[model samples]
Target: MKSLRTLRQAAAIVPIAMGRGKGRSRQALAERLGPLRGASTKVAQLLSARDGEDAGRALEPLPLARLLPVMRAAAPTLLGDGATIGAQGRRASLGQVHRAELSDGRDAAVKVLLPGVESDLRSDLGLMGWVGRRAGRRLRQRFDGVAVDDWIAALGDELLAELDYRAEAEAQGRYGRAVSSLPHAVVPAVIVAGDEVLISTWEGGSALADAVAWEPDKRAQLGEALTGAILHPMLTDGLVHGDLHPGNVAFREDRGGEIVLYDFGATREISLPARQAWRALLRGEVPAWDALLTLGFDAERLAPLRDRLDALAALLFAPFRERNATQIDGAERRARADALLGEHRMVPRLAAPTSAIPMIRTLSGLFTILGHLAAPMELWRVFDGADAPAPALPTRAPGKHVAPALPARLLVRSFGEDGRGVEIRLPFETLPDLEDLLPDSAREPIERSGVDLGALAREAFARGPIPQTLFDDVVEGRRVELRVIEA
Candidate 1:
């Protein structure tokens, strides 16, 4: 249900902040946002994994018309004197992309941040950290691993970088230079940049949405191109376009399919060892227990989830495996992942390898894109042809699965601590503000069915010491530092 406070807040901004364009009215899109919940942290970090994207897998652009005033105010800063806004424009995540007629006559897309968005972002991240850290602290009493506060702070920083336009321009420039070999992808050219504004040559071609209607081969080509663009940069150059959802990529048919990436604000850089680990994993070499530790696992806490390691490895890399999946293809994969995770049975753990977070985040986003594109193909083939030597990864024997306890024992020795040696009846509290997590869609169904949906949601998410199995899926996610605390 829309809160009275929220509805009033919407009334104040919708007219002032939304603008209609040639296509969708910006106000309509805002309404679609469903009760302007405290600034849409749903922006999901471009570099970020939503507040719970890693934990539970979790918006729209503001209008361009009403936004022109702010755009004009920042215009001279980005496009120079006499440069004014053009009528036709659209929205990008967290900002509006306006058509700008520069003083020099170059047409560009000018991006401007809405005032106060930064505060809202901080608030959302704070809430997430408060909740996640509490859960993390409990896990730590029994499990050793990534400090939830640190991971939250790192992610918060990554998301915060998107608010700075200048940082984006730098990332854009570097990415454009790095992808010279990815013939199918187009990285935007930075025209002029400012702390709050970014001006770039506008890109055109059908969006990935439009291409969904195209032939499967065309879609497959697009999927392949995008995967290569993302992988090449991260694996070879250590830079990655952290956001690659269908909305962020555009497709044009000059040859098979040319993919264009927009919104560089959320770029993430990967470390070399992390890249090598990914290469090794792809060849079926699950990293040694130590490698997993470096990648972000808390050994003592992670011991119980040993079998799920294969599931975690597969989840981190898929969206391509399984007969080359497309948007429509993840159910089988998700089911497989769910089975491996056994989220309901396993104690919750969040053991993310510190260095590999970006790659994990990218994969999370990539899996979502493949689900949207719904195009299937053999993803392993994409890497096999590369010069990166294919090390013969140790594969598991037919049906027998076993835990690497020796390595776990060794890891504990190396670290010299056994997590929490004593149990003091660690207390847990209910999830703060369970009301905040409710989905708008639930209300209508409740009204129609006379069901107590709010009660149901609260029942499931009511906070306290989070169940060890409560967020096991997130624990398995490479982006989150996780561990299993056997009760």
Candidate 2:
């Protein structure tokens, strides 16, 4: 029966995955996945969160009709007499929350797993495992050392654990107690826990989306609170809140502007050594190769690219390395990351430790939240909890080679009469291969336009890797613009 359900769900998803256009298909996929309410929905949320898509934002709470029975069935056992579960509240991939009045007259938030969601999650994971095996094979051709199976299993384990509200309640308790020292941080106290339901103190706050209207000072305070709330526990105790989204956080201006955190189903623990090494990396010190290996890279696989470790580490930890109060540019970050991967064709070679996957997810969620808050944050200060200055860009210790910063990119964009066009972005390191890399159609036109590709590249290199327009011309009825950009 589970297999049949998995098949049916997979069948339903095929059209959306194989849809015709990127924009329409993504919207269709998001719309389709939002209501599924299982691990599948989480896939959409995580991907969209990373890419800055609105898919996760569009998730609608389950209608009360679908959730009320589950709450009522569990209410007697969990809440006891005189308690009442109220209207449907926020929705998550695995559960939905409702406001309630407990028997003791205390307002509470009741979180319950969606009906049959456990089975749904198992089935979805089985399907994902099959997909991962197929993808793993293709990936192996490119990256012989990538541990795809381990990654998929780790993800499956995290998602499945969320169905156990008993565990989530405990995780919330731990996180709550850990963050108690932060005055502006709030984690609702768990009132009761059952197999599928957890009731906690009902927190009152406006949605995180409401922060846009706040004064700059208020937003900065909120950013500091959020950073402290997330980092303090992770750094001090190695306990991490792995699932964070706008819906999972709230801002309470009424309560002296508390940052209310929710949904502890997905969490992780980092080893103390790993935490220390990561701290050093964040502080702009390059750790020893053994220390870096402990942070989840596959040692043998990383050896081939060891020469570029400083640059890779710097790029990966860019958020922490920056000293200024600035908002991260996700697109630029992505472009640089993509260029790095392309430069080394390192996608397959680079293996993330299974344990680090959740940490990566946790960081992705944090970055997303901080991005939306859009306040000038001295992130290092927030991380250090002091007026510590940002360390200089990472440099190798004496006698060790330091890889230069990742190169800037050259972007070539062309539009036809009907506005259809292609944009090619190449890392500056690829400049020597410019003619070979360009398609014949693009190459022919540029050559005919009397622009010497080799000379142009040499001139750009002579001036150093900086942003400048190299070529902008109308050739053979095509409007083409080529420029250097720092990614």
Question: Which candidate has the top score in lDDT?
Answer: 2
Evaluate all candidate structures by whole-model CA lDDT and list the values in order. 0.54, 0.65
Q: State the lDDT of candidate 2 residue by residue for 1-487, as single tens digits.
A: 6666567556646655444356666555556666666887887676556444434457677777787666767667546678776764667788777888887788999888877887687667666655554434546565641244445545766787778888888899999998998899999999878887788999877766678578877777787788778878887878889887666778877566789998888877776766766666655565535445546455545665566666655665655667773455656665766775555555322445545666667766777777667777766655665323322323212221112332233333322223333334444566677777666777788998888988987865564433334564567866565544322
Listed per candidate, the RMSD to the true structure in angstroms reads: 14.4, 19.3
Considering summed lDDT, which 10 consecutive residues are worst modelled in model 2? 394-403
Instruction: Give me the runs in candidate 1 sitting further than 4 Å from their true place.
Output: 1-84, 130-148, 286-291, 311-328, 344-349, 384-387, 390-487
lDDT (Cα, 0-100) at 227 in candidate 2? 76
Total clashes in model 2, counting residue pairs 3 or more apart in sequence or in different chains:
1
lDDT of 1 at 447: 37
Write candidate 1's Cα lDDT for 1-487 as tens digits.
3345445544443443333242433333334442233334343223232111221012344656566666656665455577767655554445667777788877788877765667665555554544455445545565443344335545655666788888889999989887877778888798878777788887767755567688887777777887787777766777878755555667886666798888888787766655665666654455544345544445545666666776666564654344543333556666766677674333323555333456666776776665566766566655654436534333222211222332221111122122211111111232233234323332243335455534533543443232221211111112211121212
Each prediction's TM-score against the native? 0.64, 0.71
Over all chains combined, what TM-score does candidate 2 have?
Answer: 0.71
Clashes of each: 29, 1
